[model samples]
Target: MIHNLFIRTICTALLLASAGCRQLDEEGLQTEVTIRLVMPDSRPVTCLEIRDETSGFYNINTYERTAFPTPDTNTATVRLRRGVYTFTVEAEATYDDGTTCLLRCADYNQITQAITWVREQESIVLLLKSVN
Candidate 1:
């Protein structure tokens, strides 16, 4: 019967729509994050690392230090699963016999801004400082 065929077609359409929505929801769970670091003029950084509050730590510079672009000239970007993070950099000092130390971004900067990235968000910009 035509009525049975119409009912079946409607059910199929609804099922497909629900599937598509689930796919969209899964895709929306991730966010693209961009960290823009502001370096000091005195020291040049040799390594950079990012620590997710939820996840562990990630080394941004797996290749040669010179191979990776410095934040003084560029930015760092990564795809994260929506969470908070902290950035750290290691640099050699021009003074003090080229001493290398860990620089924490959150410690030096006074930025108390909280970002809640969502589905339509593009990228998050974080400004960090380098200290000895």
Candidate 2:
């Protein structure tokens, strides 16, 4: 009877320990994202801006930038929690006449993606042909 009781106690302890370790792993899991911005064929962009679209109690107004030929492909990596997100991007295009114009992603020009963020590296591409 004592041996049976000891075996049961050990199994119970191992079950609880495994559950705790799983919780810790979940807390440490974060989505690793790579965003790529592609410029229009006719309009060559000089700079690009990217930001998360959200306005609430916890405002996500922070943004990042990339310049021409700096990263070449205009790519940036961000870490985010598991959730649905909408990312806004603005491309600054300079014409041969030296006039620079900003093309923003809004309404029909927006890029919305749902990310589970469970994978090690997630890739997203946004083409900047929203403007003619």
Candidate 3:
């Protein structure tokens, strides 16, 4: 009888410990997100702005150069808790003919859209349209 009772007690303790650990993991969960800004032709842009609508946290990055030679120049990776976000990008885009125009983020024919970030890792791509 004592041996059975000891086994039951150990099982119960293990169950409770596991449950507590799961709760802790959920509360501290964070996701690494990669945000990419591109033009309609899949060309990378040099300016980016991201805002977490739920927490009002925002980040902005701007480069002086007009051309982004590499994909890394227009991509940003950040660690964020689960939340909805708004991405805004504005930059000067130079064409092959030496023409320049202002570009801004556009999603589904809209100027800006909310993106939900909930997965362990996410890659978000935003399109930039000519603002002029």
Candidate 4:
């Protein structure tokens, strides 16, 4: 149970909107994730994306990674089968906050665990603030 707030910069989200649609019939499962991405901080997040960590694996986005509100309001959506997925949360909190915080870089973003569609979700709260 790694529930510590470990923030770090990794890489940009994997844009998986190349094809129009992807087939998941062989897997024998179907689900739709209603992801509500919100920065619990005092300000709104610039942008966000949910992409798989493992390269070459099935993409989180079936058609496009920039889906506005597929599952719910204003959050990007990714529809696929029910299984474990290694994904990260990529979003620019702010560009010019006019501060001197060393941990305000883009690489200092947070990520979620191995997301599963079958399990019941509580809530994903991201507290973006100065690491001072």
TM-score of each: 0.43, 0.48, 0.47, 0.38
How many collisions between residues are there in candidate 4?
Answer: 4
List model 4 lDDT by residue over 1-132, tens digit each.
Answer: 233322221111122332223333433465555555444454443333222231111334342132223223335444555555444343323323533221121221222444445533323333333445
- Give the range where candidate 3 is weakest over 10 consecutive residues by summed lDDT: 60-69
Q: All candidates' lDDT scores?
A: 0.46, 0.52, 0.57, 0.36
Q: Evaluate residue 93 in candidate 1 and report its C-alpha lDDT on the 0 to 100 scale.
A: 25
| Tens-digit lDDT string for candidate 2 (77-125) | 7665544454445556565566666555432222333223457668776
Q: So what's the TM-score on candidate 1?
A: 0.43
Model 1 agreement with the true structure over 80-116: per-residue lDDT tens digits: 4444333333432232445454444544112243334
By lDDT, is 3 or 4 better? 3
Q: How much RMSD separates candidate 2 from the native structure?
A: 8.7
Preferred candidate (lDDT higher): 2 or 3: 3
Candidates 1 and 2, the one with greater TM-score: 2
Which residue pairs clash in candidate 4? Answer: 8-107, 9-107, 17-63, 17-64
What lDDT would candidate 4 get against the real structure? Answer: 0.36
Model 2 TM-score? 0.48
lDDT of 1: 0.46
Per-model clash counts, in order, read 0, 0, 0, 4
